[model samples]
Target: MSDADYFKNMPHDKNDPNPFLAIYMDQSIPFNEEAKAAYLKDCSSRSRQFLLPVLRPFARLMIIVLQLYKIIVPKALTSSRLLHRVLHFGMKTFVSPSANFMILRHFYLGSEVLGFIRDNVPGVHIEMNPLKPTKLEPVKDDLFLIHDLNLYNFVINLNRELREKGTEVTAQKQLNFSSITSSRIPIEQMPRRWTNFMDLTTAIECFTPVYQLFLTDNDFWRATNSLQLDETIGILASKIIGSNDRLALINNKHPMVPLTTLKAGFRLVLHGLATEQLHALLVELKLKQQKEAAISS
Candidate 1:
């Protein structure tokens, strides 16, 4: 019987039931899930599933809303300072640090995933060169990155190319994020603001049992890493960064399906200015490195 005809899943190879142990055995995973949820063992509630025909008007209204709003939404990043700061508080409080970190990590992970496809596939596969990883040097107040992690990552990518050729920079650098964003949103307000930034850990430990009543870490990770996910966000980064640096291997893919909503467009804008400022910082570093080399020689 075809898999399409019924719910079907393959049997796990008992001899190698846990294959991830082999795949990542030598490498340190950049993110770790610390929570042990008994909920994952519980069977899903198979409640009656039926789409209500009564909600047709509500669905139609949403379509109309999308049609009206999509026309005015900006397709790329914005330069407005006020808008960045205004959205700062809400995004900081409601969004998990782990979500922000993984999304930031997506900039690299997506590129790597696509690259593996290109090298492995023989027929008309496109090249996907991984972006150079920017190793942040130890600095005071580094935790401020949790304030606007997307912008922080955007800047890192913006400077990566220039840093690659200009000088033999030590694989360490301090980011003065204030130079990029002067927002007075105190870093203290961000959860776990004092935690070590360099550690390869996740904020999954922070979710409380009360919060997990509806959706546990298992649901969150599965959703966050896949659909309802950043594959779309990856699409945005690919477009902004360069034509060659795109993440989606699937043709005709967009960050938003059917429509790009106003809120989604605003995210692109948030990454704009700080990305610009971070570029300037790297440019200055290149010049400084050259000047020091000249003086010593």
Candidate 2:
């Protein structure tokens, strides 16, 4: 069998769940107007009552102060690893768990979509590949949906380039032709946002290349310190690839979960906070909640 055929026919591990796999299959299906309306309504109700509206401004201010401090303070004084750890600890200790949950709730839909895909779609699996060396060390596992031709093309091209340059390429690096599904489309034709979930799956997949570029671009890293690049890229790419046919990967015509002016402003503020800091705070809050539950039980 040819190389592509092998990947297409590769055995799928039944236990693994991949959220993006659902996104891949979702493309072939028609848009569900009722489901979209229900999701938006649920989001609206949650946003209206959450403390996110009130705390967003304060979070924005804190982030600004932190960034300014990093810029103005000498690297020698600010480089203390211990001091950074302590500050992170303090933030984790004080930040309210509810605040973290409210902010992260927007992403929960992805997990829910993955669960649905696992139950409904047979033979779906998540494949991980090591990224090239960049600012981030040791490389990390990038999650990809098996049977996704678009993703397979990306992996195949990336690995081919790496191999030509004498970089060690493993079996995982090559496209599993056996796993390749006919539903896959060209990278440029990939949808940025899914109508069913209103999630930015395609945009996110497109971002893998952009992120790889950023990691290797020394000048960009030095200037921005890679701060808020995730949000920055998402917003810019979404606008540049406007919702349309041909090159347009996203269909903006679908009913989207409304992010009111205030909510958008709040998200902007939240974006200012370092991603790692927010993650740390969320982890700490989860631990605290687990302990509380244990005590109650």
Candidate 3:
């Protein structure tokens, strides 16, 4: 598996005004107006682009619905045994097994990349405090993680418990990218599924402003952190990966969920794939450069 520093000092384009986009941007798959235009294209039935463009409309509506729903049923945002049961049931029975793998794998990879960015890049602040008001060490568990937000919560609590125990970093996000990406995951995972895959983008783009369009920054945090939709989708990336389902591995983050756990998880798939897609393009550029240099020399 490639280490976290695998791309250490790797040459990435720094032309974009946004730092994160700049880190991932490349000339070939340039993150420009053209790439943004293609963001909604129906690339292939198997490609993530296929369903995401379609979901943007309804998902935009659902954002207001989720917000109003939050206003009406605030408790649904928090931990609920019943909601977990419903989410678990909907996932296990309705979501395809291959799709589950894709969702979980996306989470697994997403966690790694998020962590990588935070570690490698600057100004991508992701700070967490230990769980306090409790004497017990963070409850040591074998949970796998799928979402970084949940991870944001877990390690805060998990390390609080592991504090001064001399334990090595066992949190899943610490693992190399290839640990999950190169594994025996099924190919052609899904053709039509990926429920929350586009939710984040939809919320940011069509639902926020009266232009009612794309969340900039403050709103993105307000929507995800304040609105707590992540808790709602945490099943696939959080519970299934940690606190509950399958998303964690490698001590925890790098581990795999039992196929049985898919019966009870919900998560996103596109954003992470988009990140990986850019990284792959970067790798391709390097390979091409190597070939040209070798021939010229």
- Winner by lDDT: 3
| Tens-digit per-residue lDDT, 1-297, candidate 2 | 422233334455668743333332343332222222222232333333354455445544543444454455424233223332432332233322222222233222222222222222223333333221211111122211111222234334544554566643222211222211122111111111222221222122222222322222232123132222333222322232232122122222121232222122323223322222222222333356557779999
| True-vs-predicted CA distance for residue 104, candidate 3, Å | 1.5
Candidate lDDT scores, in order, read 0.29, 0.29, 0.33
Clashes of 3: 25
For model 1, the stretches where C-alpha displacement exceeds 4 angstroms are: 1-94, 122-297
Candidate 3, position 14, lDDT: 56
Model 2: lDDT of residue 35: 26
The clash count for each model shown is 2, 13, 25
State every prediction's TM-score relative to the real structure. 0.25, 0.26, 0.34
Taking every candidate in turn, the Cα RMSD to the unseen true structure, in Å, is 17.5, 20.2, 16.2
Ranking by TM-score: 3, 2, 1
Give lDDT tens digits, candidate 1, residues 1-297: 321111123345678653332322322221111100101111111110112223333444443453444335522222223232423332344333333333233333333333322232223223233432222111112222222343334334434543654532122233222112122112222233433221111112121111122222342222222322234334333333333221332222332453322122123222221232223333344456567779999
Comparing 1 and 3 by TM-score, which wins? 3
> Candidate 1's error at 143, in angstroms?
19
Worst ten in a row by lDDT for model 3: 133-142
State residue 155's C-alpha deviation in candidate 1, in Å. 25
lDDT score of residue 119 within candidate 2? 25
